[model samples]
Target: MSDPILKARGLNKRYGKVTAIDNCDFDLMPGEILAVIGDNGAGKSTLIKALSGAVQPDSGKIWLDGQEVAFASPNDARANGIETVYQTLAMSPALSITDNMFMGRELRKPGLMGKLFRTLDKKAMEDFAREKLAELGLMTIQNINQAVETLSGGQRQGVAVARAAAFGSRVIILDEPTAALGVKESRRVLELILDVRSRGIPIILISHNMPHVFEVADRIHIHRLGKRAAVIRPSDFSMSDAVAIMTGAMEPPASMAA
Candidate 1:
C-alpha cells in the first residue's frame, strides 16, 4: 500500500526480567482500522502504551508520516497528532459535554492588559462541539450542558471519540472500546469507529471481541506471548482463521504471519 501514517519497527517493552512486548512491527494507514487481538498478557496493552507514549519501550523505532519520532510522554504523543482513548473514558461525570470537549484546551478571551483572561467562550465552544458531534451522527444530543454520567454508554463513548477527533489528531487509538457495553451499545460504538475511519483518520483498535473486530477492522494483527504473531488483511482470512490465530490454536496464513 501507500506509505503508512504510523509505523513501528521492532517495538520491545520489558519489566525487569519479563519481556512484555517483543519485536512488534506494525503499520496503520489513513482511513483504515487495524485491530490487535491476543490473550491476556499477550502484550497488546504494552504495545499500545509504547505507541501512545504512556510507557517507554526498551528498544524500538517509531515513524510518523515517514519521519522518525520518539515521544517522552503522552502529551508528547498528542503533540505528534496521536490520541489515545482508554477504556475508562477518562471523563468527569458531572462535566457538561462542551466542558468535557474542551477540558484541557479551553477557549478564553484576553483581558486586563492580556495578563488576565475573561471567561470561556461558552457559546462558540458549544456550537463547535455540537457540530462535531453532529458530523459523527450524534446530533440526537440536544443539550451540550447535560452531565456525561446521564448519557448512555454508547453516547459517552461517542463523546470521547468526538473529543479525540476534535483535537485534530491524525491517528486515534481505542483500547477495548466495547468491552463493557451491551450488544446494541457495542454495535453503536463499532459504527462510530467506522464513521471515524471514513473521516480519513487512521485508527488502531485494540479489541478481543472477535465479531466486533471482524465487523470494523480492515486488518488484524495477532499478538502471541508478547510477540507479533501475524498481520492479516480481512479479505485474506475468514473469521474462523482469525479466531485460530487469536487463540493460538493455529498459525497465521504463511504470507501474513511471516
Candidate 2:
C-alpha cells in the first residue's frame, strides 16, 4: 500500500520488427515480492533488462523512489540502489568468495605514495563478507577464501545473492533464481528470497514456477506475449487462475488489462 520503490510505466522494447515488450507497467513496493510469470518468449527477460538498465526501452519512464530517472548502464542502476541477479550467476568460478564479493568495488587502504596507496584491505573485506553471508542464512560457509567453484549450486546462488545485497540496493531483481536447482536447493533459494523481502528491500522475481510464485510472492503479474496480462493479489487468486491468466485462458483484471 506504500508508494512503490520502483515503477515502470509504458515500458516498451523492440528488436527490429519483433515487439518483445509493449506498454508494460510494473511497480515494486518497499519490502514486497512481485512475481512475474509467463511462458517461454514472454518478454520477461526483455522487461527485466530494460528495468535493470542492461537495455534501453524504446518507450517508457522508470520512476525510482517516486522520481523519474534514466540509467545509462547497469552501473548507473547500481549507483541508484537497483541491483539485479541474472540467471547466469555472473561470477568467476576460480575467484575466492571475498574477491567475488568485492570484485568491482574493492576496499582499499592508504599507503606510502599515491600510486602505492591502493592496497586491498583483505581482513576487513573478509569480515564483512562473512557478516553478509550470515545475514543471508549462509552461515555454514566456513571459508570466505574458498574458490566459488567449490560451492554447491545452492551455495553458489547464496554467494551471488549476498553480493547483490551487499551492494546496498533498495530494489533487487532476480531472474529465474531457482530455475536449475534441485527441489531442496530451490526451496533454499526461495527462503533466501523471503529473507531478503523481510529486510525491507523490494524484489522483482521473474519465474515460471506457479507454485513457487504463489508461495513466495505478495502479488502476481502475468505477462502474456510481451504485455502485462494481469496483476492479482495472492489472496484473490488461486494457482489455477494465475495459470489461466498467464496462458490467456482468462481475461486479465480490468485495471491491469487496460
lDDT of 2 by residue, 140-205 (tens): 999999999999988999998998887856988998999879999999999999998888888899
Residue 96 deviation, candidate 1, in Å?
Answer: 1.4
The lowest-lDDT stretch of 10 consecutive residues in candidate 2 is 109-118
How many clashes would you count in candidate 1?
0
Candidate 1 residue lDDT tens string, 1-258 = 799999899988889898899888878887789998889999999999998899999898999999998989988998888988889988999999999988877887466623475677788899999999998889999999999999998899989988888774789999999997899989888888988888889899999898888888988888898888989887778878877887789977777874
- Alpha-carbon deviation at 111 in model 1, angstroms: 5.5
lDDT of 2: 0.88
Worst 10 residues of 1 by lDDT: 109-118
Stretches > 4 Å off in candidate 1: 110-115
Which residue runs of candidate 2 sit more than 4 Å off their true CA positions? 111-117, 255-258
